[model samples]
Target: MAQHPTDANVYFVPARSKAPIFASVSMFVMMMGVASWLNDVSWGKVAFFTGMAMMIATLFYWFGEVIRESQGGHYNRQVDVSFRMGMVWFIFSEVMFFGAFFGALFYTRQYALPWLGGEGDGVMTNALLWDGYSAAWPSAGPGQVGGHFQTIPAWGLPLVNTLILLTSGVTLTIAHHALKAGQRRALLFWLGLTVVLGITFLFLQAEEYIHAYSELNLTLGSGIYGSTFFMLTGFHGAHVALGTIMLLVMWFRALKGHFTKDHHFGFEAAAWYWHFVDVVWLGLFLFVYVL
Candidate 1:
C-alpha cells in the first residue's frame, strides 16, 4: 500500500484524472446553453438540456472516480488539507455569488425604487419613470420589468424549507460523526437519509415555485422584484440540487465501502459542500423571503 509520510498506516494518494476536464466541459455546455437562452435562440432548450445532461453525467462519473480512489487508499492527511481548502474557497465563491444578488436587491429597494417613486426630492431622468411607480420593496410597476409575482412569504414554505435544511444539516453532521467513528453502517444510513431529506426539500421548493408562478402572480417578468426573487432563490435552489447530488454520491460511496475512519477526504469534501449550501439557503430565506 502507498503510505503517508506523516502516518505510515494511512495511504497517501495522487490518483485522479478527467474530473477537471469533465467539469470544464460541463461548464462550457452550461454557458453555451445560458447564452443561447438569453439570446432567444431556437436551440436554447437543446443547449440547456444538453448542458445539464453533460453536467449530471460528469458529476456521476467524476464522483465515481473519487470513490474508487478513496477505496484504493490514495488520499492522506496532506490530501485532506487540500480538499478542505478547496471546499472553503468554493463556498467563498458561492458567497460572492449570493452577495451580488443581495447587492442588487439592496440597490433596487433602498435607492432606485425610492428615486423612481419621487421620494426625498430627487431630480433628473426619474420623472417619466415615476409617473405610475410607487416606492416599494416589492416593486411592481411599468418601470419595473416582470413586477407581478406576489412575494413568497417567509412564514410558510420558505420556513418549512429552512427547517428541512437545518435538520438535514444535523443529520449530515451525525453521518460525519459515524464515519469518523468507523461506524460504516450507521454513517451510510444517516447519509442516505440526509439525501432523502434534501430531495424532499427540493421537491417542496419546486412546488412552492409553481405556486408562486400560478397563484401568487410572481413571475420572472414581473419586474425587478420578480427578477431578484427568482435570481436569489433560484440560485439557492440550484445550490441545493448540487448539494443533494453530492450527498447522494457520498451515500453510494459509503455503501461501496469506500471510506474508512482514518481516511475520507471525499466524504469530508461533500459534507463541506452540503453545509455550505445549507448556510447559503439560510441567508436566502432571511434576506429574500423575510427581509
Candidate 2:
C-alpha cells in the first residue's frame, strides 16, 4: 500500500526485517571462507564464492525493498533527514577506516623504519638484530622479504586515473544540475559518461596491477611497501567499483522518472558517495603515488 504525504506528522515504522540477520550471516561466512582459504582448506574457494553470491543477492533484494518503499511515499521529511545523517556517518566511518591504514604507513615510514636502521634508541637494537641494514623508503625489511622490486611510476597510469576520476566528478556534477533543471536528456548523457569513465578507471587500475606484478615484481608479498600500497589502492578501487554501481542504479532510476527536482535523496546520496571516492583518490595520488 502507498502512504500519503498529507500525514507527514505520523512517522512511518516499517515491519521488522530479516535482512540484517542475513547480512551478518553472509559476512561471517565470507570471513570464515577467507580464513580457511588462507590456511589452505580445500573447499575454501567454493565457500568464499558461495558467501559472496549470497551477500550480493541479499543486498539486491534489500535495496529493492527500500526503493519500493521510497517510491510508494512511505518516507517523509523526517525519514529524509535520517537518511542524510546515516550517509554522513557512514562516510565518516569510512574516513576513519582509511585513516587507520594511512596511520600505519606513516608510522612505518617515520618511526619504525628509522628505528630498525639504528636511528635514535634503535642503535643497540639494530646491532643486535641485523647490522648494516640501512633504512630506505622502499625497503623489504631485514632479509629482503620478497626480493627487490621496482615501484610503479607515479607519472604513468596513476596520473591518468587521477584525471579520469576528476573528470567523472565534473560530469556527475553537471548531471546533478541537469536533473534539478529537469533536463532529462542532458542528465542521462552526463551520468552515462560518468559511469563509463568509472569503468575506464577500473580497467586502467587492473592494467597497472598487472604491470606491477608481472614486470616490476611488486606484489602483496614484496614488502611493507607492497602490502600498504596494494591495501590502500585496492580498497580504493573497490570503493570506486561500489560507487560506480550506485551511480548506475541512479541512472536507471532517473530513466524511469523516479526523482523529481525536490525529492531525490537517492541521487544525492550516490553523488555524495561518489564525491567522497574522488577525494580519497586525490589523497592516494598524493601520498601513495607522488610523495
Candidate 3:
C-alpha cells in the first residue's frame, strides 16, 4: 500500500480534506472562549464554549486523517524516522520553555527579591518589612508576602512523586523494547501499566495542590511566592496531562493492532512525550519543590 514519493497520484495520502480548516477554526473558537472567560464578557463565555466545541470536532476529524493514513500504510520506515526526529525536537523546545520558567524563579528569588528587601536600593521597604531585611533569598521573614504559608516539605510526597515518574520512565523504556522485539503481550502490559503510573502521579499532584491551597493557605494571590510557585508547577502538571493523553491514544492503537516491529512511529512519539514530561518533573522537584 506504500506508494513511491514520486508518484503524482501517490496513494501517499493526499487524502486532504477539512482537517486543516477544522483545526484552525477550532483553535480560534477556543481562544475566543478563553478571552471571554478572562474578561467576564457575556459573548466571551459564549464564544469560549462555541470554540471548545469546534476545537473538539476539528481535532477529531484532523486526527482521523492521520489515523487513516497510518492504517492505510502511507507511513513506512522513512516516514517513521522523520516522525521520531520531529517529536524529539518538539520535546526539546518544550524543555526550553519550562527552563525559562525555572530561570525566572531563580532570578526573582535571588535578584529581585533581595533588591526589593532594600539591601541596596530597596532599603526603605526592607526596613519597613524586616526592620532591617538583609536582602537574602528564601526570604522566609515577616517581609515575605506569603509569610503565612508553610512551604511544603520536599522529603515527603514530592519526593515520592519524583520516584514514581522516574519509575514510569523505566517502565516505558521496557515497553518500547518489548514492542520492537515483537512481544505484543509484554508491550501491551507494560505500556498499560505505564499509563496507570502516570495517572497516579497526576492524582498525587492534585492532592498536593489541595494541601497547598486549603491547609497551607498558599494561594495564587499570595504575592510573588504564590505567582512563581504556580507558574512553575502548574505548567508542569499541564504537560503531564498532555503526555498521559498521548500514551492513552497509543494504548488504544495497540489494542487495534496498528503498529509493527519496524513501523510504530505513533507509539514512539507517545513514548518520547512521556519521557520528556518525566524529565521535566525531575527538574520541578529539584528546583521548585526542594530548593
| Highest lDDT against the true fold, candidate | 2
The parts of candidate 3 lying over 4 Å away from their true place are: 1-13, 42-50, 120-147
Question: How would you encode candidate 1's per-residue C-alpha lDDT over 1-291 as one tens digit per residue?
Answer: 434345645546444567788888878988888899899988887888888898878887876666666565566666667778887898888788888888998888888777777777544435764575567777764455654456787999899999999999999999999999999888988998899999999999999989988898888877777888888888888888888887887787788777778777778888888888888888888878888
Which of the two candidates, 1 or 2, achieves a greater lDDT against the reference? Answer: 2
Score candidate 3 by TM-score against the native.
0.87
Local accuracy of candidate 2 as per-residue lDDT tens digits, 41-65? 9988888888898899899989988
Candidate 3 residue pairs in backbone clash: 29-51, 33-48, 36-44, 118-122, 118-123
TM-score of 1: 0.87
User: Where's the lowest-lDDT run of ten residues in candidate 1?
Assistant: 1-10
Candidates 1 and 2 compared by TM-score, better number: 2
User: Highest TM-score, which number?
Assistant: 2
Worst 10 residues of 2 by lDDT: 1-10
Q: Tell me each candidate's RMSD, in Å, in order.
A: 3.2, 1.5, 3.4
